[model samples]
Target chain A: MTGRVPEGLRELLAQAAGEGHAPWRTLLKAGDWALLLMAALLVAASYPLLWRGGVADRAIVKRDGQLVTELALNTPRKYEVVGAIGTTVIEVQPGRARVLSDPGPRQYCVQQGWLTRANAVAICAPNHVTLQLSGRSGQNGAYDTLNY
Target chain B: MAPMTPSTIELPVTADDYRIARYAAAAIALTVAETALPSPLPGIKPGLANIIVLVVLARYGWRDAAWVSLLRVVAGSLVIGQFLAPGFFLALAGALCSLAVLALAQYLPPRFFGPVSASVLAAFAHIGGQIVLARLWLVPHDGVFYLLPLFATAALVFGAINGLVAARLLDLPAVAPAEAAA
Candidate 1:
């Protein structure tokens, strides 16, 4: 509470401060180098995959914090998500998605977009419709189902 | 430079050596805390140890924090088997975002903000980074609608804890008595 020393906290502080230069400068240099290396590694990893196509991931649908029962769509068609007891219908169109639900206090889901790619999701808190996305590129039946 | 080798005075690390042990310690603590912290919702953790990373940034330097984070992410992920999971990527994005926040917070005199503020900023940046990365790699199409209140909540709680720890780290005596007297 008192911004200054408070004994117990001070003792622990003594523990971390430890001894020497505090390695502040060394840490900066190391972090930048590491991030650069990591970015390079990621891009490098993606490069091999990119020449072929793209990475695919799994997408799922959730309603009211629970997984949704059904969702199916490709590039052109729209996937509809309806909550068990809610009036919300989440529509997923190509490149983008939208929600059609009775307006409530939080209109967050209505302003959200479509779920096309892997790991994409749309949640209408009040309406209780949640759309999740998933896929991994260059696979047999690139489009997968949760049942699978 | 070689490690201090426990020479009667300096600690195990070298004078020029910059790998802040706190970063390593924090990563370990965070990884443990992340795993140990009870969660009703799976795969959602605030990464409490990031406070250590934030403190390292303020007390030592960004380079140290960055190195610590890189190692922590890679090491922590490997330990948890999340090295390449979508969630792992989110954590990576968060680490990168925190780095940016640390740089900006550098100007806000230590007395005013300290590690907690920097960490909170990092937590927000980390979440932003995760959202952007997730949208790019995992869920590109539905990126826009992912926004919600939980993101803010996660940032606030995680940031406050990280800051408090960092403040404690900075307040300690710079040198031990015998070593200083020598």
Candidate 2:
């Protein structure tokens, strides 16, 4: 490999060896630091956009793409939703709603644990049942139910 | 006596080809070795292979560095059995973007731009390219972009480290003697 060193690169290498600390001088500049700081700032800015807000005060239950019922999150209650597959039991608390039980292979809806934010949702796809949260922000219609 | 004609044409191998091959092999070795190490994050790796690319870029030039990097990506993916896989595409995208960034960085005033800055710029470009490709083809979710902060931070730290290593290597007197002898 050493035997094949090109003429141009050989000269460059000699210059590098002669300069000693020259490479270090070129490694980091003020502009590079500025770029690094900008990247950090960009990351900081994304925090709010990526943040998930707190739970909302209302819940909407939909069965087979149609509105089934609306529940006041403050009022704790349980509702039984019947679908083609089987019944799904939905429970609503002061600020959260979740699937207590659902007939599905994986019970993914129950696994979702809870939905307490304006756009949070729990769906029992096997039974075609969905429980979505909506409140003050009126961002209820912001995203499609599919996003859940 | 009839003049003897050469039986076969022998193409001379250029010095550039030998150099690129050596650097590419080193980069590939580093990449394969890195795969064996456990990573806490999906996209984060120490990126040790990047040091070779940085060294080649600083010592040789952008063109040689590009050749070395592209060869490493292709050869590395082949060795790891990621050829034509989503991983291969992602790697290719990252390599291309990083090379472009390195080329652009070369134009900066020499006093303010060196291996460290070039490495950092390339690292960011590499990660950015991979994330964009992943979001477009692999995951297709906004969730992927959320990982940018983690990836960017890793790129900065690793890039700076790799740059330092490259700069130190470039400054070595031993390397010059061998090239000078050639």
Candidate 3:
């Protein structure tokens, strides 16, 4: 209590306590602004690293969460899955997959159209069928360590 | 019945316990209340309780702030009926990560870094930890990281706002004077 207060502590107290005339100036310190700027830059940088539209190598069809088949996207083909309700038709071409037709009432899966990017999914919930596109995960390489 | 001994029967509550309890209660209340507010997305939240944590860190110290923050997550999940559930673990992960960041951030030069800076850094850590956990346990897909920019933006926005609020609260004489003693 008797010793002199450090310059940093004094300034922080004065600014936060509103001893200054300007209200905005009291809101954030120089370090706070610097942190904010750095955070923005970091966020901006993540966009390229994370939002990747990887080309799918295969299409996986599932019924009731169980894998029905893995279709190579290189070969254009059509396959049918008999789900809970009725038959759902899936068509794969080159590097994309689409639901040609489904017994689901809403047709939301069909509306999803062609899913070309990795990890894209189309669900025919009424029929309990789902289609997902997967590619070689660049980060994970050829195998998932967790699988072993 | 015979009168109990004063030392054995009395609760071991101290000044620190009382302080932590007070702050923890406030943070827990805010955590529960935040759930009532409608969110556009599932994971995004204003994280109002973090304001209390930031203020406690700046005024009391990181230890008190850590206590308040961790307690809020545990108690808040219990109140919301999500204890031992996936959501609870997500919250715990986020809180733990943020506390770790605050521990380090507190050591930065005071002239440059303050409560606001610490709050922002903690916020980023919070979201980052959550995403990593979700990727490993819930989604199990690399695609999950795509949400980073969105979550990061939310962290920055809410973190700065909460930090500002904490700063304003610290302006009060009761809170401001503690910095010198601490």
Error of 1 at A23 (Å): 28
Cα lDDT, all candidates: 0.56, 0.77, 0.80
TM-score, candidate 2, is 0.63
Q: How do the residues B1-182 of candidate 1 rate in per-residue lDDT, one tens digit apiece?
A: 56557467765556324335434644754685578678754435767657567655655678877877877887778887888887677777878887887778777653334555566567667777877776677654552233423554556565655655565565555442223434
List the candidates' TM-scores in order: 0.52, 0.63, 0.65
**Residue pairs clashing, model 3:** none
Task: List native contact recovery per candidate, as a fraction of 1.
Answer: 0.05, 0.28, 0.49
**Residue pairs whose backbone atoms clash in candidate 2:** A26-B114, A55-A116, A56-A116
Candidate of highest lDDT: 3
CAPRI-wise, candidate 3 is incorrect
Per-candidate DockQ versus the true complex? 0.05, 0.17, 0.22
TM-score, cand. 1 vs. native:
0.52
On residues A47-82, what C-alpha lDDT tens digit does candidate 3 reach at each position? 776665664678989999999999988767999999
Kindly list the per-residue Cα lDDT of model 2 for residues B1-182, writing each as its tens digit: 33398747666767667667777777887889899999998779888888888888877788989998989889999999998988889989999999989989888886765677788889999999999999888864444675777888788888878877776676565454336547
User: Lowest summed-lDDT stretch of 10 residues in model 2 chain B?
Assistant: B172-181
Error of 3 at B135 (Å): 1.0
Error of 3 at B52 (Å): 0.6
Best by DockQ: 3
lDDT of 2: 0.77
